[model samples]
Target: MGINAHFELGLGGFSLDAGFSAPGRGVTALFGRSGSGKSTLLRCIAGLERAPVGRLEVNGEVWQESGRGRFLPTHRRPIGYVFQEPGLFPHLSVQRNLEFGWKRIDRSRRRVAMDQAVELLGLGRLLGRAPGGLSGGERQRVAIARALLSSPELLLMDEPLAALDLASKAEILPYLERLHGELAIPVLYVSHAPDEVARLADHVVLLQEGRVIHQGGLNEALTRLDLPLARDPEAAAVVEVRVAEHDERYQLTYLDFPGGRFTISRRALTPGQRLRLRIHAQDVSVTLNRPGETSILNVFPARLREMAELNGSKLLLRLEVGDAILLARITRKSADHLGLRPGQPLFAQTKALALLN
Candidate 1:
């Protein structure tokens, strides 16, 4: 399924003029920093905010058409939205809060079972509890379950983890991934976190000043040297890998990427398990010669393809490894010291980067 929209709206002193389409499956992250109009664009799609000259179509269904005078009401749209806050009713129990949407529909149209939603979100234990009694993460889980139970054809999550702390964010991330992997519904996830985007998104839509700057697969858009986010100190290339083996002696899990194997800090990762690894640009170094003695376990031969200035003194390099590309950021001094240039053969060392599985 795909979503296409062209919106022109004025809110407060700023005006929004933007358009983009989301991928059918996996998370299509609306990525940008603050004041980029990401939230406003989401609201337009959700039918909460309307534009006089706007058009929106999801999964081949036209929710809005400016010229045709067609517009679908928010309640009538087959969409589920989870905002930054859980927004649960304090007086209602978690179970009752989840069931609020159920009463709006006829019994025959409700396809989502309460038991399935509870199990999917691990909300069975919290059913009897009030919203005030639950933690931030628990409340978010309940919110997700409630949204799922609404039987939406498309799910729109606008910074769902933004209100939580680091630990709380970590707690809810796995459940989000599970929902994506197991469910048939497509998700449009909005966030500024590149790490989260890299971890969860199969496709991406990068917006800036209410305009679409980039839209494609996450790897292609993220690895591009032109985008501002690619110049971040924490900029990294995300690779989907599979578990190859486990070393009992070292207590390490071996994962296979396109070029070679990588040993990461994971355990009980059975063979054939799919995983993602974020190889940060700063953590990667290019070596002209292979070192004999080193603690680094990952060193793959790659050819330098492109180089761009991260700043005046620092440079970012794009290296090719089979069909996949890896990013490395280094100083101009180091580049000149190592005589690095495009088409030069180099060994990339990256063993300290975080591995999320």
Candidate 2:
């Protein structure tokens, strides 16, 4: 099951023509700059902005077909939308606000239970409080819980953390990860922040000037040098690894992926715990031979898969390390000195700058 959509909308000054299909489960991030039609495409899927020509199907169910003259109104669509703001009812208590949505659906149709939503968002203690009394993170968590209580078939979040401060965003990110882990419903997450997309997205759609520049798995999309994401200096490859061991004395943890092992500062995670790591291209360096006595703990053998000239002075190299792929950004002079070429064996050194749970 998956989401299939095609939309073409022409407004006064902007026009949007895009199509994409993503898996039915996990999150698919709509990524681009501010005016790139991320939100507009989302609205078209939700029926908020009627496209002159469109076709949409969710989990094999047709929601819209302009040729057939069939379009489901926003209210009829089984979706829960979370905007940038919480938008909780000021007059109601937190519990009541959450119940407002749960009560609307028939008991037989309810797929998400109240207790499940509460537990997933950690809203047990704040259930009795008012929306005004909650912090930005807490309020957003409640908004998410309320949305879940509605038993939506699809969850649409349009920059749910955009309005929150940095601290608040950090506070709520773990809960979002929990949601990603526990929910079976598909989520369409809209955001311009690359870090957020790398942290949460399973699939990615890169929109530029109302067109989809790329659409694929998060790792493949981010590491493609021809795409906008890879052009950014901070572009990275995301990998999933498991905690293999912990060194309490040194305060370090060893993470194992199919390629090799990564040693980072010890987290609260237990052995066998799964984690996500974002390794920036700039943090990786290529070497012809494994060097002895190096401070960098992560040095693995990789084969050069592709190399693209990013500019006159710099180049981007894509390397295959076992089952995983990594991108390294190095100067053209260095590539020339090393005689880098596709299918060449080399060692990649990663400093492990950023690792997320």
The C-alpha TM-scores of every prediction are 0.96, 0.98
Best by TM-score: 2
Estimate the overall C-alpha local distance difference test score of candidate 2: 0.93
Q: Residue 269 in candidate 2 has what lDDT?
A: 83
Which run of 10 residues does model 1 get worst, by summed lDDT? 102-111
Q: Write the per-residue lDDT of candidate 1 for residues 101-136, one digit (tens) a residue.
A: 866657787767788888888888899999998899
lDDT of each structure? Answer: 0.87, 0.93
Kindly give the stretch of ten consecutive residues in candidate 2 with the minimal lDDT sum.
Answer: 348-357
- Each candidate's clash count: 0, 0
Top lDDT prediction, candidate number: 2
Pairs clashing in candidate 1? none
Candidate 1 lDDT: 0.87
In candidate 1, stretches whose alpha carbon ends up further than 4 angstroms from where it belongs are: none
Point out where model 2 deviates above 4 Å: none
Instruction: Measure candidate 2: CA RMSD.
Output: 1.1
